[model samples]
Target: MKIIVVNDSVYPLTMGGSHRCVFEQCRELSALGHDVVCVTANEAAVARVQEPGGFYLSTYRRSENSLAKALGFITEPARIIGAILREKGGEPVACLSVQMFPSLLGLIWNVPKLPPFYYVYHGSYAREMWTQLWPRFKRSLKVSDLLGALYGAMMIPVERWVLGHGRFPVVVLSNYTRRQLIDDLGVKDDRIVVVPGGCDTQHFSHSAEGRARIRARFGVDDDTSMIISVRRLEERMGLDCLIEAYADLRQRSEKKVKLVIVGKGSQRDYLERFAYERGLSSNELAFAGFVPDAELPDFYSAADLFVMPSLAVEGFGLPVIEAMSCGVPVLATSGGGHSDLVAAIAPQCVVPQATARALADALVDIFSGRTKLPDRSACESYARQFSWGRYCSGNLAVIDRVLAQKSPPAQTRA
Candidate 1:
């Protein structure tokens, strides 16, 4: 099959779970002998390039200006559609995998002649924005927060229009997002399918040598427990809660422990300042910003546990699966996909709430041996169920089903 995967950015170039999902699926599709072309809006990309993963990449130039960047969400896809039309000559490909920003495509090109496509809905943009900015608006009542809230408020309708525009099948990473679509956007239940995110079990497997090397590099001895979190430093990501929890754990636990946070984001400076203010010293906490993709498995191997403290709009927690694939147990807050994964692996690994106190208590229980976690072998065994092959199988099934359907009436709304 010939597939055109449309997304905002490709993985490795733009690091995120959604990008990784799209990239991995493309790789799998190519491996399955399909001709795959990834269309992205990465400014660094050339006109057309082929990835080592055996798929072609067609990138549209994106502007670097602040205003252009903000409006690029809508404008960029228009350029993408133009590129697709110019390249394909208004002809339909075998399949279209719309990963992000489905608005312009649905609005501008909903002709019956277009090929069947399915939108991979990561999560509701309105819910994600409101989750991050609503707290700030409530606390400060700032104009920026007000504007952000309004923007988020407006996305509810935007999301609705995009999902309903073509009545296309929507594939989500979790049932949480499926529920959100049904309740929030009025998307029909039958149109949504839940396919969990995946981990590369082979690449992300445990290595005793890697564990030793990474721990030594981080200055954490085997006797000293190390809690690892690989998350972007954003408000909804709940890294602030993790830092506070780590601080609390230090005060009460007699065992030596350290926290190593990997990844970079806008909240890095604030998180560093917040850590210090919470009385965490350099010895107790380390920020390893922007580690390369290949080195992530080593970091996971070095950790005794992985924690995800997402406060809201966490469609699927990919890091938890990655860590588990590396034979590490996970502790995640109860809500969204991380908790779902942890609960399925072992119910004891999930924290009761997304609060600092709850995280601290969970840490205490695990360290004190009051809560028994899944063994390394078990963690690895369970992680195999979430491989990219498995994810792609479910996704491909949806694609096949969409392709078999008759073209629905063209619908549009603003």
Candidate 2:
């Protein structure tokens, strides 16, 4: 099969989980004897023009931040169109779009020879701004709150229109997201399917030597109980709540503990300030911003506990799964799709939403022997269920079905 995968934020350009999924799925599909082409809005994708392993590449100038990228994709749709046109001389192929912005590739140009397009909805950004930002921002009135509100207002209509306009099936990460698209966004019930995000189990597997080395490099001793939360520095990530819980944990636990926060984003300074205000210091709390994807398994292997404290807008908690794959136990809030995954793997670890107190108690129980985690082997076994190979195969099956039934929809964007 010949295929084209569309996503502005793909691997090597952005470390976002959805993009990582795009990278792995495309790579695996290419390995399966399919002629795959990745059309991206990522400026850095120029480096991959010749050949990125088995798949081909195309690039465009997609700038920084959500707002700018949103505008760039709409204003400059030529790169995506040209890539599709170049492939038009061959056998008819299907394009798998990873999100809303990239799904507009054909619609923006009104391409005449477009093939079947399959849409993948990671989550609703509009819902994040509308539901998550308003309550938090109205109190402080940060510029981000206002910007998010505006972005949400613009995205909700475009999101719905695009979902309705296209004659393609919507691929979602979980049952939770499928329910959200159908119930909240008015997408047809049969239009979406749940194909969960997958991890590279081999890369994320346990390593005792790696754990020792990573901990030593990070200035953590073997005796120190290291708790790590690898999340994008954003408002909806619930880092503030996690920090508060860490403070609370310090007061409750008798053991020596340290907290490590990873990733980079707009809320870094604000989140750091919140950490300082909570009485945490450079000694107990460390912010390791933007660790390389190759080094993540080491961090997870070194951690005593891996946490996902997302307040909202988490279509799937990929980090939690990664950490689990490394044989580290996970503690996550019962919000979004984290709960469903956690419940499937380990239900005892899910905490109630928006409460540091509950999380603090859970932390104490885990470290204090009040709550014992399953053995590392058991944990790794559960994590292996969601592998990248399985993820690609599921998406490929869907693409095949669509390719057989429907002709590509004509451009309907206004």
Top candidate (lDDT): 1
Per-residue lDDT for 126 in model 2? Answer: 62
User: In TM-score terms, which candidate is top?
Assistant: 1
Q: Candidate 2, overall lDDT?
A: 0.78
User: TM-scores of all models?
Assistant: 0.89, 0.87
Least well predicted 10-residue stretch by lDDT in candidate 2: 98-107
Give the per-residue lDDT digits (tens) of candidate 1, residues 131-235: 666676776677667666667777767778767654788899987788878887788888888999898888998988999998998899868999999998878
Q: Which stretches of candidate 2 lie over 4 Å from their true place?
A: 44-48, 86-88, 105-109, 128-149, 164-167, 407-414
CA lDDT of 76 in candidate 2?
45
lDDT of every predicted structure (CA atoms) = 0.82, 0.78
Q: Score candidate 1 by lDDT.
A: 0.82
Candidate 2 clashing pairs? none
